[model samples]
Target: MPLYKTLDPNSQTHVKIWKITETYEDLLQPLSLKPESLERVSGMKSELHQRGFLSVRHLLRAFGYTDLDLYYDEMGKPHLKDGMHISITHSFTFAAVAISDVEVGIDIEKQRDKIAVIAHKFIDYEFDYLNKYADDYIRNLTVIWCVKESLYKLFATPGMLFREHFFVIPFTLEDEETISWIDYKGQKCRFNASFLEFEGFTCAFTLPS
Candidate 1:
């Protein structure tokens, strides 16, 4: 089943989350496919690849678009001719997407305690900010991790370090979302990121403003 959530920042955008609950045959729906795109979907088994295609199709149907009018840029960013921005993500059992006139990114992550072990790689000055929260530390760290990953996807950059290029502004646990930004090579982009706890997983997404 797919879960749908709306961000309050922009009334025009919609976010959808899909937890993989169908088999390959059921989710792919080969009998209902167009030949060319069907061939493409048939060629992969990486869960992420399959879910990406399916998620878009799910959105298309939801929006009353039946022909799958989508294309990808050289950088592999998917675009719609009718002009809506899109972002996609998937994990072992979940997939997510957000579409809006504004650029956006969404990420879902299984909440794990081990995130602390590798924090140094993606974390830079942000460590100072995180260090202030000594209790429930792992949960907060996972939030930062997901927020940075979403920002990187939104930025579409291959060489960004979460810790070095972006920062999540401090917010309390009661706050569902927080402010974050990327200062990449002096180019700045601000993002509003939010996370919700889902069955032991933490999912976060960013909307560019």
Candidate 2:
């Protein structure tokens, strides 16, 4: 089994992580999917994206959810039949999902140096805190990118320009974990975020505070 790190904090949020691996297909065999759902996903060009959904669905099934129990809203945000908050994401090889009684969001990304070239597009206020040294730039960019992506998924609102609004507090890249706040439309939402380095990929997730 892939390692699952679960944090059931006493402080109003619960989180868990399942690292994606080559065995993702095997793990998905137990999930029963409807023909309609397959037809819907079949149009996606990336086989990786399709498998990511399969892995996510398997995890939800293990948590006692059936295929038809999950639905997406008009904005393409997911909703649970039982009314639980849900968020999902998949990178090149990993897929992640977060569920909470309170609203939640999660994101995973493969660490890549290319993010630095486009940092100015998705990052603004976070730049001041990032290490400008070439060796540290990519890792720093990855963390900030992951943080913003998580916030985007959490808010599930269109027209969210990352550079214009998202801001990550200053912290050492070596810390591996941090707590941050997001200012969205006058609401200051607290987030607890952490980074994991595995198999040359980096992933991060946040839950409401």
Candidate 3:
């Protein structure tokens, strides 16, 4: 499929999503990827991952960019050739890209019961407001995971651990928004975390507070 959805939180930021319904050859034939990128995708063990990689490239085209115009840092964070801040994520059958003039990160995750098992690994302060018995417990956990992952990508700094450094403020599913903090080394930074749910998946992005 073509671009599945596009979001604009402000004049300078754009988030685009893609649903990967095309076959590997269908996705690969349209775009021009550098040799390294071709080799990179060719080495993938799963076709699902390969399609996810191609889908993100198609998203860049939706924003008038090409695969060559995108690059990654040593931290594995994505960047644009024009100095724009960018984040890319793909999970299961979906892929998304976010671009902004300011620091930003984005993530998409499938809402699954399995997230609860690893909750303690990346969750700390959020537990205070989270009730395990609530009907929305799993949904809430998915959102928190999505938000924190985005923050991690946006911060893109080594030595930052989610449980130790990221704290999400209280939020409800209806609100679709929240505040999050990065506290480490006695220094703290704030960010705005916003999210949406569709097709049993949640996508979250972070920007300056």
* Best candidate (score: lDDT): 3
Per lDDT, what order, best first?
Answer: 3, 1, 2
**Model 3 worst lDDT run, 10 consecutive residues:** 1-10
TM-score of model 2 vs. true structure: 0.85
TM-score, per-candidate, Cα-based: 0.84, 0.85, 0.98
List model 1 lDDT by residue over 1-209, tens digit each: 46454444568777776666667766776335667677887787775677666765765666545445666677777677788877777776677677778888777888776788888887777676676358767778888888988887777877777878889988766798999999887788788898876766778889875
What digit string (tens of lDDT, one per residue) describes model 2 on residues 130-184? 7778687787788888888888877888777788867777766688777767776
lDDT value, residue 11 of candidate 2: 54
Whole-model lDDT, model 2:
0.73
lDDT of each: 0.74, 0.73, 0.94
Off by over 4 Å in 2: 1-29
> Candidate 3: which pairs clash?
none
Off by over 4 Å in 1: 1-9, 30-37, 46-56, 131-135
